[model samples]
Every structure is written in structure tokens, then in C-alpha cells.
Target: MEIVTTIRREVLTLPAAHLGPDNPLPPLRPLDETHRVEDRDKEDLPRDMARQIDYAPLHSLLPVRVRDGYDRRREPRPIDTLVIENDRLRVTVLPGLGGRIGSLVHRPTGRELLYRNPVFQPANFALNGAWFSGGIEWNIGATGHTALSCSPVHAARVPAPDGGRMLRLWEWERLRDLPFQVDLWLPEGSDFLYVGVRIRNPHEKPVPTYWWSNIAVPEDCRVLAPAEEAWQFGYERRLRRVPVPVHDGTDRTYPRNSTYAADYFYEVPERRRRWIAALDADGRGLVQTSTDELGGRKLFVWGRGPGGRRWQEWLTEPGTGGYCEIQAGLARTQLEHVRLEAGGEVSWMEAYGPFDARPDGEWTGVLRAAEDRLEAVLPRADVDAARTAWQPYADTEPGERLATGSGWGALEVLRAGWKLPGTPFDESTLGEEQQPWLHLLRAGSLPEPPDSRPPGGTLVARHWRDQLETAPATPLTEYHLGVAQWHAGDRAQAVRSWERGLRHAPVRWPVLRCLAVADQEARHPERAAERYAQAFDDLGRVRREAGDDDGSWTAVTAALGREAVEALLAVGRTGDARSVWQRLDPATRERGRFRLIEAGLLLAEGRREEARAVFDAGFEVADLREGDEVIGRLWGALTDEPLPEHHDFRMRPTP
Candidate 1:
């Protein structure tokens, strides 16, 4: 069969020659041994419980990628690029790269609706690290780039019921042990694309999962949504309610005035139809809307500052100014906030297309006009007709089923029974493990203590102490004991326990992390810095040995190294802090928190001109008091004046 290559609308697959061994995608790291459990029967459990409960291995773990010594010279390589188009809209998908929509073009205007990266560049960004920025990335399973991102998936071209064509991408996520598929349908004469997603748990056991479709558009675009309130986590990690569209009397829809990067998750008003759009000044932009099938619309803005600009460079090639993400999810917020049940499945359909603003209209008016246009573009008949034709594709059998069409084999067309997404299912939520303390102890890698309901921190610490006295000091037991001691206000004892654990289990990253925190709290900056640095090194060694090098582990180590820098700065070790800052990846330093630290270091070195330049590059200092103190100290350091007595120049970096 001859492959069609034309401007006419069609779905065609092309080979991706850019991916190879020298620049291979990051591999998924296995669950940490502390969290791994062979079986509950192997532990000293009650006889009745041991006989009745069958504990399956918690295989669906957090996805971690290790990126140490990664090759940055790799060019973009897509396994297969599927192009679907109509006269007004054209979309390109890279099935191998997490089935991401590589590019979407408004054909009539010849403008790209999505931020199309010239290359497939994976960076240490997502929660799991190794996230590619441009285009639309499908995040399934855990919150970060789903385990499938940067991995190949099953793809096929199927006939659309509307006499057009559809491209299907399906993958079995090993970690979640669930199957998910996304079908991109382009009808014969439609200007918009219909996206149908289905996630099913084929196992008898219940699974927890998340589904988020992330759409990237131009950074400076204004976001218009039907929301009056939003949910955001503050610097202290506390969730707070704030006004949507505007916060603190400032419109958040536009990025120009913001001083800091922020993520706003909105509780979209309950309505039959919900929509969100990112539009340029001319009113030409991308719009996304869905039926009640999906909820939780969000806007992730990266401010147009030095840190944001540096991140854009890190995420993509130069000249493609940073882009903002308009995300839609299935749950209230992120993945950890929701779960899926056994034999249960969730399905949803969403529409994406281009819209033009009304002439001489303000942003609010333009938004209302866009909504009116969307209502007309996405009618009930069109949605129902597409759903009627696409139901069979989503209702396929669990695994290895024959997908009859287009001369494709069963294996080539349908793949199923992959891992489910998200963290391990809480056993306490099960029938047998009802004891709260027992569940906590088991999850923490500790044996059931004498008192299942240890009411207070003191009691918990005593129980852990008794267990340590009776049993050998293994890394897990020591770490748990240290946590209990810390909770009981025995910081010194906790430090000792962590130190002892490190001596016995020298490579335990968790123990080192605990020790570092304890040192920091105890005002031992030097010791804290040392412990953090050691932990960073230990994580790197483990990643190398496991051959799981990617951004996930790199993110952890980079964070630890940043903590070390902060500790060094606290003790006035400017030279050491500068050395550590310089050693960080340029991309990591480009983050807002690190940029501030870099400027402080330059100020400490008496390079006033360089420090001023860094400050002028746009720093998102949210706390006015802290910002003032830092500035005051820099001034005092340069001059011979004494610094203010109450001012604390050292500040913890915000993520």
C-alpha cells in the first residue's frame, strides 16, 4: 500500500530516526527496597491475620528517573509521527514519545496553536523528572509525566465511523497495572479534533490512578475560564482558597505582572459544559472544552522572568519563548487526591480547536465570545455521533485481543493489562488491615508494635525504642525510630539514631536525609551541608548501579544539593555556597529559588555590578520582608555599616 503524503486531510505514520542508544530515553527506576515487601506472611504477624490476608507485592510504585551523565547532544527522534488533519486544523502525534501531540497548526492562518518544540528534548522537570515541554503531553497514572512518557506505546490507524480517520494510541502502565488508551478522531469535514480517553482496571484488586491532559500554548497568552475561585498551595505547602482570574486584585490570567511562578488548580463550576482557553491579543488561540466527563481545569503559569526564561531554554531549543500549560484532569486536583476501584473504569471526551477573538473586544468579552463560539462548534449531535462510533475501541478485552482492521495484527493493534497508575493501594482501606497504627507501622517498614493505637508522640517513641532494644538495628527500624524521636521532641536522640543507622547502612539515602534535616534544625549548618552532599552522592551511585539514569533521581539530588547550598549560606560560607551553586546543572540554576541564591552569592563576592544585573533579570521574591532583609544585608556587606540586629538574611528556597 502506498503512503499518502499531501496537504489534504489524513492520518499518516512516519518513522522517527532521531532516537537511538547514544541518546536513549530515561528508564523507570524500581521501587526503593524500604517500600518493597515480599509478603506479610514473612513478617512476624498474628496467626489469624497471616492465614487470611493475601498481600500482593506493592508493585505500583512512584516513577523515578535517574539522570547523571546523561547525553544532552541527542537530537529529536520520534518512533512514529502520526499526522491527522482537516482544512482548518492539523495535528501531529509522536506515538513513541508518550503518544504526545507533537504539534497542532491552525492551517488557515499557518500559526501553531501548541508550542511545537523543534526537537524532542527531555529534561528533569516533571514530578518523576524527564518531561518534554512542547505540544500536548498525556499524563496518566501518577501526577508527573506518566510512566509511559518518553516510552513507546501501541498505535494504529482505524477507520472513523464518520467516513474520516482516527489514530489510536494505547499502553499498559506497568506501575499502575492498568490500561489506558487515547483516540484522536478527525471527522471528514470538522475543523476540531475529538479526544476520547479510557482507563480501566482489569485486576480484581482496586487501583489508585490519575489522568491529566496537559496542553502547552504561548506563555504570554491570556487564560479565560469559567471559574470564580481557585486552590493553590502556599510556600508552606498549605492549601489555600483564592479568587480565580484575579488574586490579590491582580488578574492571574495574564503572566506579565506576576512576580513568581505559580500553579492554579480551579474547582470549575458545576456545569454541563466546561471550557478554558489561552488566547493571543488578536483573539486567535487554542480552546479546550469537555462534557461532564472530565473536571478540574487548571492554569500553570511560568512568569516571564530570568528563571522562567532559563527554564524555557532548558525545556526547548532557543527562540521558542516559554509556554504556559492549561491542564484538564479527571479528579478534583492532582493524582494523589483521587483513586480508582477494582473493575471500575473512567472515560471522558474533550475537544480542542482554534478560535478567533471578536474585533475590539476586551479579554472578558473575548472570553464570553469564545464560549459562545465553542457552544456552537461542539454540538450535542457531533459528540454523540463520535461517541457511538468510538465505544468499541475503548471496550476492548483486557490483553492481547485481536483488533480487526487495516491489515494490522492483534499484537500490533491492541495491547492491554499493563501496570496500573499511582501509589500503592492502602491496605488499611482493605477488609483486614483496619488498625491505623498497624497500617502506619507496616507501611513505614516496621513490625507491629505492642500498642496498635499509640496515642501520642511520646508513646510512639517509647514503643519504637522498645522495639529497637529487642531487635537488631536495621536501617528501616533505625529510620522509623529516629522519626518517632523527632516527633517526641527528642532532636538529639533522633540525630544519634540517624547517625548510627548511617554507620550500619552507609548507603541508605533516607537515613542521610533525616540526619541532614536534624542537623539543620539543630543549628549545625556545616553538618547539615555535609549530610546533604553525602546523600546526593549516594543517590547518584545507586542510580548508576541500577542503570536507571534519568531526571527523576537528578531532581532529588539537585534538591538535596540546593539544601546544602542553603545550609552553607546560613553559616556565611559564601565561597562554598558559590562552589555548590556553580556545580548545579545550568537548567537547575535557572529556577527562581536558585537564581536568588546565585545573586546573593555574587553580592557576597563584592561583584556589585554582576549582582545588580542578576537582580535586574527579574526575581520573583514573594515575601517583601525577606526580600528587604536580603537587600539590606547586601548593602551593609558592601559598605562598612552594621547589619540590622533582627534581620535574618538566610531564607529557605521555595520550589
Candidate 2:
């Protein structure tokens, strides 16, 4: 059979909600995530394992803005896709969406090897914000979903090791200021798709880096990997080493066996083959194998719980089949980050193909048969050789640009004057967002923001922080400086900087809002409420003075107003919360999130039926968090009415 591979561009239309602009405010607020796995499980682990589990998480997303602007309303939107295929298989990549491989098709069998979503519903899941389920997402540079998940990445055709065209997706991750590239192609007559990933650190110092390739597979399949033990981390905030395949008399390898969402990180021995497969009862499904560099394999199951099922529906249409994630990462678990040294780089190759093994009888036999079949068909040596052959092409300059990504990388290149090979973040990609920073680079000072709104943007990279420290000590400068300090984990100094800015800020609300969040994080509820009230008042005055240029200003007012009401409610300031709510734009008041807030206020005012009435209207909090049970708790407070399916997103066992 002649093997002719081809790559081309196409359009895929889906019902996708626009990923509205990011929130203007920097994320200075405290994170309420459960403590890392080691907090409760440290006593029983090896020293190194425990230490790895204790990796620090970011307190805030300072430089990168929070993406809370998107709403739940969606319509059919045309999405750009790159299709690469051989005679045997086809892969569809959504380059505009973090280069996510949206589909993997076994052409001969006419079966989709991945859990392809029928629609694109943006949710509050990514590290920076706005994430969707399904497809293979390239999780890079952080513990959570990549910020680039909903954003575009530079995509272009590159020379493939097999003398064909490979689709290369490259992007600059803002959080850690790192550049990474992913090269994907299909070899001649090969059953598997080859993916080569490389992350490089151009800085003069070390940087904490994380990488995970997340593949969404059908939930009904039984997951298998080469391991006898695994580390389980659940929303319950506890980590324990459980037996592979089965634990507590439950065969967890099947997604339906568990009652809540959880992650199982397989403890594959260093010398074992690196692979994982999700196969049906007949033992045929997608198998992912990678070179030794990508050692960790994980299974994330949205189990048989009400919340899990509800989330499945929320991410897709009502009747779409559910999916589970089988992941490969650079560390032992997603909880850890590998420190890539200065001038260092990490690269690896992974293959995704169909694995067929029908080893009945015993679990051990099944594992043995699967391993033997995988090694025989596609040995580890071939993957290593693929990586070796792909290296030269990985450095080849991209040709015929297929898509464009954020201008952050180009701005960095211009500012630092660093040269990168293979992946080009061209200067032509710079946009309006980079203008002020470019001015800061050219002129030693940043221009003051026109209005009181958080300066058009804020950059918290170390160099930018250094520049802020040396620039004029203006209110705007101090406000930005505080954000950088907070991102660096110096809460006290950050508060001092914000307060210093507040002393002389002409408008006062910008820095005051930052101070309000600082107080909230410090757990001074009363102070937080008071500060929020003051900040809201100042902002309201500005909003009134500005009048109506467009509807955007009103929207900003509503956004801040919502935050103010929440703060006021936390401290028993019912009247103040009501006042804030009343001041919100009439249209904003109708949003599902606002309706929920209204329900909260009604409950606080002892109007239980009114609160229940709000829920009876049936609303969806577009930004509701994964583990937040606020809606259920609110329902209980109102009446004993059964919790609505749309409102149940509880990820853990009820306390």
C-alpha cells in the first residue's frame, strides 16, 4: 500500500460561546484550593515523593488577566482547523484553540479514537480561564489547564522527520515566560500519530515548568497502564496510594466504578515501559505511549456521581456520551513541576494509535498481554528513534503560517533581543495590547492610564517588576508594583505598596480595590467589606462622571458591583449589598450569576421563598466553579426541593 500523507486547512463549525475579554483586574485575590496532596498524606510517603508533592502553587495570576467575561450564551461559530492524515488515520487540530487536537479518526474503521465534543462550551477550568472538555489538550507551563486553551497558538507547516509536512504549534506561556512547541505528523503507512514536544528556557536563570498532554477518551472503556500502585487525588483534598485497577473492592479502571471525580497517577517503575490504554470490554481502543522523558501517566475520571454526570452534560450537549482524561506528564504527578534549568530544554515524543489485546482471565494477564503486544507492534526504540529523527526538523523554520497566537511572545523577543530557532514568534504579531509595554521598553517609563480603570493591562514578569521598581513612584506605578509583589508572594509588602498608592491616587478606587482584595486574603472580613464599599463608591462616582460613552463602561460598573455585593454579604452588611445590587446595570442584573447573587441576598434578608423563586426560574451560573456547592447549599436553605441537575457540580463527597 502506497503511503501518502497530507496536511491542509479546513473549517469546523460548532456552537461556541465567545471567550469574552479577560477581566481587567489582576488576580490578587487568595486561592481557595485544597492544600496539595502532601498536607495530609506526607507521613506515609518516601522523602522524595513527599517533597515533590509539596510543590508550591501560585497565589494569583497577576500579569495574565482572569477570563471571567464569557457568558453561557452560545451560537454556531466557525472554527479554524488543520487536518493531517495518512491513508489509515486522520487527525483534526484546532490551532486557534491552544492547538488542541479536536478529533482523531481511525479512517479504515470509521471510528473516532477520541471523545470528540459536538459543541464547544467555555467553562471556568483553564489556569487563566475559559476551558472546554474533549479532544487532546496540550497542557503546558502550569498545574491546571493552559491559559492558551481557548487562545490561538502560532501554527505553521514544518518539515517532518518522515519527509512530510508536520503541523507545528508554538506559543509563549506568560505565567512562566517560557516558549514551547509541539510538532505532530503521521509516518508513512503508520497506524500511530507522532507528536514531538519541546519546551525551552531562554532566560539566564531556572524556571519552574510543567507539561501534560491530556487526551479525552470515552468513559466506558477500562484504563490500563504498567503499574501496581497509583497515587489518588480527589476533590476530598486527600492523597493516598491505592492498588492499580482495583481499590476498596471497586474496579476503578472503569470510570463508572467511582462515585466522584478523581485523578489516579500511576506509579510506573522507572525501568518500565511508558504507556496507557483505554479499551472497551472487547479490548480495542486508543493506546498512548511515549518516550522515557514523559514518564508520568494519569487517569482523570468524571465518575458516576450526580455532579460528575451533570458536569459531563454541562461541557457538552445533554445526550453526548461522557469522557475521561488519560494524561502523560513530565513529573510523577500533576502536583509537581520539573525545574528546567537556564539555557536548558526538554523534549519528548509520544505515539497515539489503536491497541488491540484480548487477555481475559486475570488482571495481571491482561497487563502482560497488553505490554507484550504494544512492545511488539511499536517498540520504545522506534519512539526514541522518532524523537531523534524529529530533532533536526523541530529546528527547521516554519513555512506558510496557518494561524497566529498572542503577541506576548513577539513583545518578549523584541524586549529581550533573544533569538529562537524552529518556532518564530515574529514581530508582526504584536498588537494593541503590547503597545504600552513596547513604549515602556522604548521609553524607560510607562504612561499613566487615561482613566481609573486598571491600566489597560499589567505585566508581572520579573523584568517588568524590576522596571516598575525603578520607574517613577506614581500611583499607577505603585498600584502595578503592588500586584507584582503580591504575585511574588510578598503579601505584606504588596499591601504596603497598594496603601502607598492609595494615599495619593487621584481617583483612589483602582488602588483601593487592590487593597480591598488584599484585606480579603488577609481574612479581615470587616476591613474587606469596608474597603470594598469605599472602592465601589469611588468607582461609582467615576462611572457617573464618565456618563455613557458606550455600554462597556456600564458593564465594568456591574462587574465591580457584583464583587462589592459579595464582599458586603460576607460581613452581614445586607443593606449595603442591596444597595450595590440595585446600582448594577439592569441588563447585568438579569445574568444567571447575578440571579444567583440575588438569591443569596434574599436568603440573607430572611426571604426564603423569594430566594427559592429565583432558583425556580432556572438559571445557569456560567462561571460556577468545579467544586462549588453554593447553589446546593442555597437550595437547602430555601427548601427541601431536589437540587436541580444543572445546579449540581459538587466534585467531592458531601461532608
Candidate 3:
């Protein structure tokens, strides 16, 4: 079974919840950027640091819709999994979940090298919402997590460098508009698994690209990387350069040594061989090394604090051990994106395997011994040579299709006539979501949904926006134009387009909602609230007249209703907010998110007892963001009662 790859499907019957259909509303504005770092905290900085970490140019999650329609009701669901293994190592890949490496086992010792989660619990971690922890997650696109974290990516069987086969996963990352591939293979008798990654920019201009292969390692291990100084980013969104091994009187190399969660990105010099290791007391754990192009190495630890511990439990099952992340990326830090020039591509090789080093002692000695042992086992020269040997096979066409991903990539490729040699987004993969856009591309007009359904997703890519600009100007076109313009940071034009569309729009709620978002961003909270109210009322009327039997309109209307109530509450319109909440469908109000909203409303009205009761009745918010303080604040608002154990997800030191 040396290096041979055959694709077969198996069901991982974990107690996992479902990622239901995405929210229908478009994410018009950019999310608050988490890459907040002050200049005073830096030591040695890159010359182009300002441009790399500045606000994102393409910020909206358009065409690629938000995946926020999941809940916490766990069932014995069967997850789609694909396996690729050789004699020494057996690897399981979750193609349907961002091509995540679900498990990597060392057959000789029967050890799981990476942290494998016992359950598949979806949380509000991914950029688009639903994300599960554990395994190796491929993060591509902007800062924060990838929009494709819980989504599928195309997978296939491809030839390896040694005339054997390897598993290849490829997808068109919509956020940055770049196509990338990840190829995984294990050699005949090799202990390490080789991963070849490539990102291509087919456009005529440069695109800022971010790629991080995040490996989850057991928290019992001490993380070591070859750097004396590290840039640390905390939940405060502040970045500071601190000494490695020890910082703030804590030996920072150990995962649980700190009291709060943070990221330590090693500042590896240009000449140093790139590698990071998480080794236990006996110095045996996972070690990751890569060729030159993949220059970045980072260690992310969920500290031993209550919030950190709660987060650890949140992502997995009870009585399970926690894990930290040792990641490799294309930049010095996860906060920055490397430049991929037009018509250019960046490719590199990475190897992951079990490492045995000298026993733990002084940090410096342990790191040196670990580095020496890694070199002895899988030399730096061998990594580079393997990359050189793998370049030819990187362009080898995929042999057999094992799984399919989103059709957005196929739409882009078909529109641009791009010749991506190895990663083919075949036309057959195009589904209903892409059909309207396909019609728009071919017929020069995007059509309205059948049977007066709500508007579908909008495309905000430059090419698509240009197409929208040229297409005939109807209410539908104008509404879509507004979405495209809004996504590109053209607020004034987007508003003008939406207002124009409203003049004759038979379906005015979508346009009105866009205007509401624009008003909210422009600081006209009152106007935003009014527009939201109007939008919600219009949508409610549509649902009533249409007599929705399938509850589809109810969900969409309920989503809009939540936004409307929040907008009303922002301006202290408690009564108005209550009215909006009261109008929501009864079943929708029972959701975890809505229940929290219910508590917020009661708290706002000084009904502390009712709010406390809402908390007393245990509820798990499916979309509770990492570092979210709402639950804590609400618990405090219902002051005099103890904060519930389920609600204490604080990751920062209390003020």
C-alpha cells in the first residue's frame, strides 16, 4: 500500500448537528476587522506592513453566502469522509468540510499525531458562521477564519512524485478570488506525510492571499519554533513583540502556562529552516516543517483560564482533552496576507510526522535538541528536494473525482475562460445557485426568482459588478447593482442604486434592507431603524399574501425581524423592538439566538426577573461568537444571580 491512493466514502457517525440552509440576506458591509495591532508594540516590522494589514479591499461575503442557519441540536448524523493512507501513516480527510484532515495516525505506535475531536460540534468560529474545531483546517482568504471552513472543496486522486497516487483537494477561494490546491501523499516507507500547496492568481492584477495550514496538537505538549522573538496577538486585538520561551515571567513555550488565549507568531529569519513542534515531556508529538515559500509559523493556545477552558469544551465533548494549534502560512503572521501578483502563482511543500526529541529541560536545550532530531529524521534538505521533485506532479491533471464543492468556482472559471490545469471546476458542478448568474452572463440580464420568492445571492466580484453595470437597468438589476457597489466600498453609489430601485420595486423589502444597512453604517441609527421596520413589514406582508406552506419565508422573515428589532434597540426604541419581536413566527422565537434576543428585550425593559428566568432555562446559542460578552453582560444585568457555568466563556482577564 505504498503511496497508493483510492478514494472511498465512509460515514463518521458523530453526534453532530446540521448546517442548514444559509441566511438569505446579503452581508452588505465588511465585518469589524480583527487584525488590530498598534505601532507602539512592535519591534522589527515589515516595510509593507501598513498595506498588508490594512482594511480588506473585497470585504463582503456575497455570492458565497453566510452559513449561519445551523443549531446545537446534536443527532447521530453521518458525516462524509474520504481516506488516504499508506503503511506508516493513515490519513482521513473531510472533503465535505473544507478538506480538513480529520485524523492522522502513526500505524507503528498506533498514535494519533493530531488532535482529533470526539464530536462534530458546529460553532460561530468561521467567518461565515458554522465551524467545528479539531483536525487540520485549511484557512484561505482574508484574516479571521476561512469562509469555506465548514463548506466542501473538490477532491480527487492525483499522481505523486514517486509514481504513486495522492489525494488532492482544490477550490476557488471566493474571498480573495484565487484558486488554490492542497495535495496530500505519504511515501513508500516515509514517516512524514508530504503536502504540496499552490495558489494561483489568474486575474490581471495582484490579489492579497492568505493561506494557513492550521494543525491541532495536544495541549499537553510544549510548542517550540526557531525564533528568539515572537509577535503575540491576544483577544484584545493587540499585537506585541515579546521574547520567546519566556514572556511576562511565564515560560510561554508551554501551551497552558499562560492564563489567556493568544497567538505567538515566530519571527523566523530568512536563512533559518522553517519548522514547529509540539512535544510532550518525553519529547514525542507532531512536528511540522515546510519549504521556503510557506514562511510563517504560529502557535495558538487556548489558555487555562475559565473562558479558555469553556471554549475548549464548547468545541468538543465533555471529558475530552483540549488542543492548541501549530500553523504554517505564506506570511510572517496570520494577520497579514502575502501578495500574489497577476498571472503568478506560489507553490511550496510541507511535511508532517511524529518527532522524538531529548527530554524536556531548559527551553533552549529542548528546542535545540528537537531541531537536531527533526533534521536527523527528516532533514531540511530532504524537504526542499521533495518540493523540487513534486513541482512536475503539481500540474498533473486529477485522475478520478471523489467529491465536489461549491459551483461558484465553476462560474468564475467559465466566465473568465481560465485554464487551471490541475484544479478543474467542471461545468457539471454548477448548481441552482450559479444558474441565475450563468443566465446573467450569457443573456446579459439576471432574472427574478420564480413564484415571487425572496432575492437570491448577489455577485460582487469586479467582473460580475462590471457586468451588472452594463446589464439593462430594471428594479432587479438596480437592486443587484446596489449590492455589488456596496460590497466594493462604494456606499454612496450603492445607496443611490437601491433608492432608484425602490421607486418601482414590486418587492421593496430587499432594497429597503440594503438601505437600512447603509444608514446603519453611515451612523444614522434612527433612519436605519425606520428602514428596517419598513423592510420587515413589507416582508411580512409578502409572506402573509404568499401563504408560505414550507416555512421558508418564515425563517427569512424571522431573520429580518431579528435585525429589525436590534436596529430598534440600538436607538432605545424598546417598545418598537418589542413589537418587532412579537411579530416573529412562534417557532422562530424558540431558537437559541432568538431566546437570547428575548432575554435582551426583557433586560432592556427592566424586567430583570424575566431575563434571569430566560437564563435559568438553559439555552445554547449556536451563533455565540468567540469572545462574545453578551451572555456575561446579560447575566450581570440580572445582577444578584450567579453566572451560569454554560454562560461563562470569557477569555480575557475581568476588569
Candidate 4:
């Protein structure tokens, strides 16, 4: 297979097209009026001496672009197979559309597209500057040494053989007018667009390159992620949901209000490389932000004002709005590079668009359903203890406890040859074998104390309901709930519960173990991270309370610690998480459990080298035996990729 990559460049000049009615970007304002005096002082100093000065004009240093006009309805010959248009825009498809050179974000807009390079702007300064002083400024400016080019363009579209496919080049008047489009196509659908640009990289070493979709949202918007807790700046309603230590060592609390305009970045440090973010699209979009590979990857969100502040107050600013950035690398962090032996190709793509939260569940439901069915076969004895423990609080809102029962019930129904009572879940949509028995569990929110038992038995159901009520309500509880929710097809609810659990009780051991399981099911990682942190705290506390000489806690603590590290990997926070795991007590570290956890996390992060190291280390404890169920779930959570064909099940041996 052929690979494609985009070289990154810095925007040195501002384009005029971005100054239209919708995008009114303000110029970079100087910190002090005597800007010329400072410039002169630096002009005469030694090159090295002058470089030491932290000199950054938040607006001036930022690359600005303005594109005039661009059409999506036309393109050049031979490549054109068809032309299609709606009242809004046109599309063209060429031979290379699906090949390497395809444009990831290309579409026509009514007005111009001008945005200041956020990577080089004030937000970057505020977040990175406080600690490094000028160090952050210098690193950012130094890396931003790239040339800027602009093209004036107008609209056009080219067609492909398939009705949904199209390819073509558009005319541009300036940088801001570069067109972008979001096309949702059925299988076998295609579309393509081409535009011209000038790019340059200044580093001695060829640095990897990537771009971000600078999208603007209207005043009213709501955001959600699968994370239990999130990084908080000065956003509105920032509260410390999860007590994970902040990188800066400050308090770990989030704001209380829900409205905010500052940039909040979340890092997803796992290997699956899948992500989902959504906003309430019913109202005018209420967000704006940048996506640059230079910053850490994952997701970076910006809104009108601080959480709880009115949109009008925030949006009225000259260049203030909400935004969600899609970066080629981790969000809020710098780009990472992998050194190839000799010949190397580094390719990336940046994308951003309006999304309906409802549809995301529809798209990924197949895998989710399969996972749900897989767990349904376990006997109640395996999970019944957890259920029995929480039944007292069953009167309370099930909170997340609802999910554990749901997941278990789903598995039970499937093993018993049951199915959802609806048309979509029938044999046609999901073959009889794949049909989920849990769908027939309930109609509304999980009823409290109401007799809703699956076909097999009530002991397991009773156990789950009991634990749902009186449990410490920690991360583990949330994780189990999230798993249940996921299996029951309450996708959004499952994610929300997991995030909430992690936020409030991150140090709980159960949460970390379950977070890994839940995130794997959801195809995301942040929640798993929250769970990992809680697990670490839980195991650490146990060790401390047991005293240094306690060997049992040492082994158990190391085991839990390793599991936490694995959870971090499950959610894509391997680098830092691994560092934390490695620092455990030496005795605990000797047990191969840590290595196994490390291997699992590395595998999740796609670090085969690191994973292999841990996998090899596992041989030291090769003779150790684990309960069959633990081994099965551990394997399932770690290698959902090419899932293991047969697990060592107590129920039966494979022929």
C-alpha cells in the first residue's frame, strides 16, 4: 500500500480574505506601546543576547490568512468522471482522489476563511509561558520559522464515475479563501478537490508537518468527551472532578460554571487512534479554536467565554468565538517524530466539521454490539459478588451501577439464546448469533428495585442492584456502570457515567480496572486514564497503610499499579503513565504483573518495542497462574484488534 504525508509549515504573513463579516480577526496588539524602542534595543544587541529576550507580540507572531473566493464545482480533465451540485456547492472526482494526494479538508464557504495561527498566538503563550517564562516563547517562535504563500481562488467542481465521488481544483484570491467541505458518503462513495500552496520548513532536521481545521462555532454550544475528567484552564465552571496531579503542580480543580472561552486541551495517549467529539448543533455553533500538529495531540476546545458567562459577552470581542481543533498530532502538545532507519515517509491529515452526537453511536454500533454479546455468557457467580455488595443503595438512582447489571444481563441473555424485541436488532440487522439479549432488558431508565430479571436467574441481577446502591461509588463502580451502559446500547450514557466516576473517585482501584474495560468498549481512552490514576492512588494508599514491610500488599499493590498503567495505555496516556508505573517499589516491580500491565499499555499505545519488552519480561513469571476468568477478560481488553479466536473458558474446552 502507498502512504501519503503532509509537510508542516508556518504562516508568516496574514492574508486579507479572512477579514470578512463572519471572521473579523483582530491584529496582534503590542504589550507595550514602546514596541519600536524594544525592537531597537534588540537590533543592536549580540545575536545570542538578543535571542534571550522573550519577545512575542501575541497577534503579530501569529500567521494570518485570508482567501478571497473558491468554487468546488469544477476541475481539470482526464481525472474528471462526473459533476454533481446542490444549491450550496459543487464537487469533482479525479483518479487520484482516493490515492495519496487527496485533500482531507476542502470545501467552499459563503464568505472568506481567515484565521490567526493559534499555535503562535496568545493562547499558546498563556498556557505554555507561565512556567518557562520566555522558554515557551522561544521554542514556539523558533519552530515557527516557515514561509507563507497565498493563492487567489474561486469556486469549481469535477465529477467521478460514482454518483457520490467528485474531484476538481478551485480558484483562490488569497490564503483565507481556500475552500473546505465536509462530505458524508455511503460505502463506495467518492469526492476530491485540489488547491495550490507554497510551503517551507526551517529546521536542520526535517520536522514532521501537519495542519489544523480552524473552525468557528456560534454562541450557543455544548461539548462532551468520553473522559471522566478534563484539563481546566480559566474556562467557566472548571472543577477538579478527578484529582490527578496537574503537570504544573497547582490545584487540580475544574471551574464550577459551564461557560468559558479559554482553550482546554485533552491528550489521548493510546494506540487505537480513534476519537469522538461533539457539540449541540441545534443552535448557532458556539466554539472556535485551532488544530496544529506542533501542539500536543488529542482534542483542544474553545468557547465564547468562561463557563457560565453569557455568549454575547464573549462573542462580542473582535476575534472571539468557540472552536474545536482537529490536529494531526496530539492536541495541546508538540508534534512527535519517529526516526526511520534511512528512507522515511511521514504523512498526516487534519479534519473538522459539524457533527451530530446522535449519529456517532449509529456508526460504531456494530463493534459495540459484538463486545456486548461476548460478555453475556458468564455465569452470575463471576460478577454476582459486586452486585450483592451494592443492593442496599438500590433505591438511589442506579447511577453507573445500572451498567454492570446491564452488561452482565446482556451476556446472560445471549448465552441463553435471546434477542432484542425490535426490528433493527433482529436476525437481519444482527445475525441470530450476534443478537444481544440485553436489549430486551428494559425500556426506560433502569427501574429502581422493580423486578426486571433476565431469563437465567435473579441472584446475579439482585447482586448488581445491591452494589449499585451502597458501593463507595468510586471509579470502579463507574467503570462497571459504563460497561453495562455500553452493552445496553446507551452509548452516551455509558461514557458519561465513566467520566463522572473517574472525576470523583480517580484513586479507586476498581475504577481503573473497569475504566480500561469501558474505554475499550467505547473505542476511546480518556476515561481509562482517569481510572488508572484512581487505581494508582488506591494501591499506593494500601501499601502505605500496610507499612513498608508488608509483602502481600507489595505484590497486590504492584499488580494494581501495573493494571493502572495498563489502563493509561488503554486510554492513550502511556508515556507519562508508564513513567508513573515504573516508579513503584522495587519488590512490587519484580512481580511480572507490572510487566504484563506495561505490555498491555504499550500495546494499546502501539509501542510494539516497549510492549515487546514487557511481553518478554512476562516470561520471568511464566509459571504463575491466574484464575481463568481474569485471564480471559485481560486478554479481551488488551487485544480487541484481531480478537483471540478462543479463550480458555471454564465452560468448555475448544475441540
Per-model TM against the reference: 0.58, 0.96, 0.97, 0.26
Alpha-carbon runs more than 4 Å astray in model 3:
1-7, 39-51, 55-58, 640-642
lDDT for each residue of candidate 2 in 1-655, tens digit (9 for 90 to 100): 7758888999999998877767776677655444356455779876776666565555566577777777877799999999998988899999989999999998889989999999989887887668999999999866788878888999999889777888899999888899999999798688999999999999999888899999999998889888989999998878889998779999888888999999999999989999999998888899999999999999999889999999998898878899999999998788887888999999999999988886344788889999999999899899999989998888899999999999999999998998899978898999988877887788877787665544666888889889889888888888888888888888799889988888888777777778888888788888988888898888888877766566657655766788889999999999999998988888789888899999999999999889888988888888777677888988888887688777889998877
Candidate 4: lDDT over CA atoms? 0.30
Instruction: Rank the models by lDDT, top first.
Output: 3, 2, 1, 4
Q: Which stretches of model 1 miss by more than 4 angstroms? A: 1-69, 74-79, 234-238, 359-366, 396-655
* Tens digits of per-residue lDDT for model 4, 433-487: 1222232233211322112111111112222433433544545445545554443
- Kindly indicate the candidate among 1 and 2 with the higher lDDT: 2
lDDT of each: 0.58, 0.86, 0.86, 0.30
Task: For model 1, give the RMSD to the true fold.
Answer: 13.6
User: What TM value does model 3 have?
Assistant: 0.97
Candidate 3 lDDT (Cα, 0 to 1) = 0.86
lDDT tens readout by residue for model 3, 477-582: 9999999898887889999999999999988899999999999899999999999989988888888888888887865887799899989998999998998998
Q: Could you tell me the TM-score of candidate 1? A: 0.58
